[model samples]
Target: MHIISGHHHISMLSKDAKLNNHFYQQVLGLRRVKKTVNQDDPSMYHLFFGDMSGNAGTELTFFEMPNIGSTVRGSNAITQIGLLVPSYESLVYWKERFERLAVKHGEITTYAGRDALHFEDQEGLRMVLQNNNGEKVPDTWQAWTGSDVDPRHLILGMGTIEITVRHLNRLANTLTELFGYVEAYHSDNEAIYQSVDGQSFGEILIKQDLGPREKPGKGSIHHLAIRAKNEEELRYWEEAVKERGFYTSGIVDRFYFKSLYFRESNGILFEIATDGPGFTTDSSIDELGKDLSLPPFLEGRRSEIEKNLLPID
Candidate 1:
């Protein structure tokens, strides 16, 4: 079984939609590719922000669930997310640029067999820069050079997602059996299970700890997604997930991609998503984010949804 070819996406809960919008689109140079409400909960905005082309790996999405309580960081929830760069030179460029701009960053270090640097966003959302050699699914990321960036040379999927979990083995098995991942290697405190081909963009590492599970809230991970090459693969995944008796959701359209959600045995919320009907679904390259487009199911409530969200830009 293929454990999915690429890193489809990552979801985060944001307290301020507008602020998250500006930082990701204007500051980080990501394109506000789509605007819509959360499928599960229609009141909140589900925003997709990624590189110019909205490729699978480069996406950084947010759910404007501003009312969720503040987070108390711990294991069980994804602690920090990492974006893999092309090479060490790219990593160095980011480090220097963040420093020059006074972006708070931790000292650089080697991690999980790669060189890395860590930092947080304005809302204290943890993120990292990684330079690692691994197998990558084909992608298109238009670097935020403003004037132009050839999408062909864009970064691949997310480098890794660090989850501080109390349960290790169950999560490992879930990924392996259902998602096509295998035990690649391990650290003293964490086991690394990756797609057999070294699709290292998405990883589940456990920092063992004993405590109550983290409550989902602001600054917390909403979900981790795996890429299915197409709906046919995604259909196979839904069957595979249900066979394990997991709580899996029906396919939900997200304009750019389709998705199915389930809680893995390790208790982390995960998704299997298709890679088609991408960013150009509703609007042209120049018209993205100019309007909030929703699936047929949620378009009726757009006005009320607009009023509830605090203005960000």
Candidate 2:
């Protein structure tokens, strides 16, 4: 099996573009790396945020709707997003910062032997600042100098995400058998899986839940993307998934990356995307996200798209 390195990016839904932009860019200090429209829904804005270079593992994207309702939490939903910080001291710095900024956060706690600071964004997306296990590659991150957040303390990249499922066996088997993920740890209710390559970005925790189902709305994850090296690998994954009786939305060209999407046995949406032709493919890196960008197909309708999108500032 061709192994998935880690996360390419994770996309979520947000109701308010300005608030989402302010929270991610100004509050969390991530750089607004790309400003584009949702390919599937050209009228809606798609925003990308990440570290300075907007590398694969650091990306967090959003679909701006302005009026979407809140997500209902239950099975089949991505529950939390984990951001990796360098050390225990980094957690301390965030604790003080979250308090001063009045950001809602929970007490720092240790899970699976590492410390974490749990918090929520303005849209109530659950997030955590967690310490890495010293296995991450240093190249996975580039410094973000966009805000007062010290380069040393800025989020390194996306470390992991938590997903809730009714049963763990099927999803766990798919991850380990097909995706080359290994069971790092497990309990009756939760299990942690890590990529065999030891990359931190796509690590995931699957919580076994037998309660109510989750509803999708604003602040909910639309899909989690795992990294594929190229177009060939993406197609390979699609074939593999189809053979296993899973329905995959065969290779999609998103301009930045090619994608293949499918839901796991438990119904959580997952996407496999390539790592190249990134945000700088159109706009220069230095001027990324400064202007609204669209795919060539959508460029013809730029005037119509812009008129409908809410102004960012």
lDDT by residue for model 1 over 1-313, one digit each (tens)?
A: 5457657789998888887887675545567777877877877888887766567766778998776777777767777888777677666666776777577788778877788888877677888877855445454645544522223223344777787778777777777776767777766668887763565666655566667788777778878887887887888888889998897888877657889999876578888888888877777877776687777666687787778665555
lDDT of 1 at 141: 49
Q: Model 2, 313: alpha-carbon shift in Å? A: 1.9
Show where candidate 2 strays beyond 4 Å: 133-135, 138-140, 197-199
Candidate 1: which stretches are off by over 4 Å?
A: 132-137, 147-157
Query: TM-score for each prediction?
Result: 0.89, 0.96
lDDT of each: 0.73, 0.86
Q: Please give the range of 10 consecutive residues that has the lowest summed lDDT in model 2.
A: 132-141
Give per-candidate clash totals. 6, 1
Error of 2 at 204 (Å): 0.8
